[model samples]
Target: MDTLSLTLRQRKLLHILQSHENLITGSELASQLNATARTIRSDIAAINLELKPFNAKIDSIRSKGYFFTAENGDKIRELNRINTAFFTRDDRIRYLAFQLCLTDTPINVYDLEDEMFISHTTLENDIHTLKLLYMLKSPFINITNQHSMLSFEPDERKRRHILTSLIHRHWNYNSRENAIYENEYVSEEILDQMIDIVSQCLHKHRLRMEDTNIVWLNIACTIMYERLSSGYMLPQASPVSKPDASALAASNEILATMERLFSISIPPQEYDEIYLLISSAHILDPSKITLANTCRIFDASVLDMAAEYMELLQEFYHLDFSTDEDFYLTLLQYIRFILAPVHRFSTQENPSISKSHLITELELAWAFQSIALKHAGYYLNEEELLHLAYCISGALEFHFELHPEYKLSTVICCHEHMTVAWSIKRKLLGAYEKYLKVTALIPVNQAKNYDFSDTDLILLTVHKKISDETLGKIIEISPYISPNDIRKLEIYLQSQKVSFLYRNTGSVRSFFETAYWHEDYEFDNIFSAVETLGSEFVDKGIAGREYLSALLQRESLCSNAYCSGLLFQFAMTPAKQTQLSFTVLPRRMNWRNHKIRVIVTAAFTAADRTLVFKLKHFFYRLNKQCDITNAVYSKDELLQLLTAQPDAHI
Candidate 1:
């Protein structure tokens, strides 16, 4: 019997029927195979047809489901033994990536097709997908196809890093023991030995690393060891020099222990690679080291970079981190690790801080990433940015603790009576005493006489518009203070408190006017849209000629594509004046993975920093309140959407 005649999934279906004594339902088979019941039914029908020639069939009893009945049990057993598990497209891609990483010679496309039990077209499509998604994006490796043969030219150290990442992607980081047993590249014994060696070396060096970090290091070491054992040695030219003495010592000890246990002579380049890994590991015992000592451990360039980042962060967040030595050291250490010779993939997941809680910090982090790319030729990934945001969030908490005077000074004005004003103030104070300090209570007629200089917000019960000077601070609310009023007040208070950048700046609507709105604007990509908008700004005397270049540079660093088909592009330098150009696309176009329909090009001078900050908060509110995906089409419609009442549920 030709066992290979059946498809992988069909063979698996036959095997399942053979293994079961009692009948199994289609739903049960589908659940086990991660397929729909309909798919299972179709597979069973095809399998029965294939089994007819061998006197074997999957017979179904009414309501009892399927059972295997074979005249020749030996032949059916042979078929079951020969069956291989079905590999999904993603599984095939990973397998192909590993094959490319491990193989030295060019791989023949036909050979791969035969080995994976796929057709030539399937193999080609898989390779194409791999190249487009992974290989083309990789900085350390390149794929070349010549005469139907595929060759991967990769840096040896980077190849090991990529291999470890591939393995890490599949294995559960939470279950260290399970990861060892489940890993396919290295044996469980080898992984165990590697972990023991790393743990012991870290202990010997008094370096208390996180469990996840330890697992990451162990996986990386095991990959290096496996590769070295297979006769693939790191080139001597790739060794990074001037490693920290403690990290180098730990690296040497770990490598020496591995050599003795495995009887393999490790090279110096391998030691340097391990040293790099150790230096990058997040040490939990940093509290033991003083800030001065930590400063001495890193290069002056790294320290300067860290200081530059802090300065930029302070400018954006309006919080001085210079006095916070702990924060400085933490940021310094993180910068040092990320800017190391080899990029270390962080095992940490997205931050535990809620998106709403850390909006300011995340914004600061995003801006930090943009500048980091310009200064240092490296782009921080989303995970790295979120991790940095978490760090910033802690610093913010500390900053707020030290400075309690940053609370918003609020006032209440009621049209009904002075008693009504007091009642509104009482309700607001009851809900947000920590964030708001109710300074005054005035009737609607007496509101104009009140001095609003020290006030951050003015909650009015009447529909009367305030003076143009204090228009931005006014929030119309009901005399009874409804839930919608509370929601609006909460948003305003949170935005004002978190974003210290808000300094009595004019309203976001002030910067955006009907004149700046471009209806039915069309562009090919994000870059083109930014360039065209920037050019318009220059033509209108809102920005300088160099503003276009600045806008392009900022956009090049990282995409500013937000949710709901919106793209926010900014200039690197300040413009002549503050202006926001809103371009509503007639049709949504692709900006990387996002479909961008609205393009907001901001041209702000140094004086408009506070206004820009407030604009960001407004956008955040707009995203939460409006259905930007479907409703926004025209400029008037968008303006109306922005001017609409705040959602009561929010």
Candidate 2:
């Protein structure tokens, strides 16, 4: 399958047909697809004529435009994979990005950097961090990586899955149904190296922080310290001022020293806040940071660091400070931990590159490194600061995640049976339940004569060892391009485009929520409840009908998640998610595989979480249920006769 095979007009026409499938208006197709009606008619005629040999038919309703029957997976794959060209290095990256999204693992920036040899600057501006948009659907797939592990959100996975499915038809479709392991642990050496890099950067670099932000954080911590410590037990009297002619001289001497240190004219108001923080710590008797106090003030991740900072502070200042130093100390700690290791994005890997540009930004952040150092010499060690800047820039470049979207079709070139295809599809759906809105899975043999355009094909699995020859086939056929995925190449093309899931776990989330009540991105997993519920309507084994599930899912194409957020999910299949009853997660006796915190109406056989993304009917139903979710949650309690066995009818 290569892009060279299809004419531009033919590809455009095909896309039009896909969008308006079964009811595309002829006029609309010509207008949207930018072709004259006569030209479109000819294309349609050609398509219809092509269908004849496969014993298939094309339909044009009285008011509708056109629709094609996909007699089998081969027909659909053959119909889409032909004549596509890879054309762009960006396309390769897009492919890699898609694979990252599909994978249930943490991706490494250094690894990607080394593999692609692209500077950190390029990554930050382009494909570095995952977008915060898609959080609900694919939730991060748990997988092991070379360094630093964390969960990716659902929206990222789904989007990548869709995009991956668009190009390489038959990939890992069965992953969603099988056990998805979420443990992505890096080796001790790599993790240590990353930590060491960040530590060095933070110690020497003059970080950027606004005076107001520092003031606020200082105030917040002081207030908390007062409330938590017994220092507030006694009332304090106001201090009386002594009128002394010598005080003026003393003040002049102090001002000179202060100006030399901070490079700012002394202000009484600024000193008041700093004095208050010092005084608060001084008053706490036999002070030691307590874990209970930290829990109330910071998140789990922050609290852990807060305790350590409390110890560091006590050792540095020789004064007691709370383990939870209000929000400032802990906030600073967590922010540092999260952001510290992340160096700023750098344009070169040559290590020896002069940080002239970086120095400029640093100067803006820490003005003292100039005037203070000029007068006091060694104010903050220039060489140390430069090295810190380099690392910070590098870390910033590495911070990244994935954005997930759907694929119109994936050309699977493997010679495997349908089972492998189905398994990969399930895993991909669950993994990408967030971003990928639409996806198509196609086997390999049927792809040689196919065409994939305007399709989100998630390349989930490679049945065989993929070679350059195999990838070339996809390169010539795919339409869209993403720059992050193709950082490297190998025997097989197995990767995903990952969208960053930006979610604030605690206070930050509240602030963000206040700013924007709802985000613009749609999460496929948010509809998981519905998809899971609708799976019941697709029983092919008991019903003894092949393609029943496919037919049911297709009918739901016009829409999913009707109106409400409350969705129930169930798969109507005798060959339900797998017979294996072990949880991939290493938890014992976990409730419903541990991720489901709410009720989603799961059937016994619907073990796969991907059903969350696959079912649309439940989505529509959930919309209707949103209003009385509280009632529905309390339904079991509202009944007058709790013990009575009643009829199934409401």
* Candidate closest to the true structure, highest TM-score: 1
Candidate No. with top lDDT? 1
- The reply for model 2, stretches above 4 Å from the true place, is 1-207, 210-270, 274-332, 335-445, 448-478, 482-564, 567-650
Name the runs in model 1 displaced over 4 angstroms. Answer: 1-96, 106-139, 145-150, 177-184, 210-212, 238-245, 282-284, 291-298, 306-318, 343-358, 362-386, 409-494, 514-557, 587-596, 645-650
**Model 2 lDDT per residue over 14-98, tens place:** 5445434357666556545434467777877776665565565556766445775656523443454332233233333443445
Question: 496-550 in candidate 1: lDDT tens per residue?
Answer: 7765566556446545554487886787656678788889989998888888886
Model 2 per-residue lDDT at 473: 29
lDDT of 1 at 398: 70
Alpha-carbon lDDT, every model: 0.70, 0.33
What TM-scores do the predictions have?
0.67, 0.18
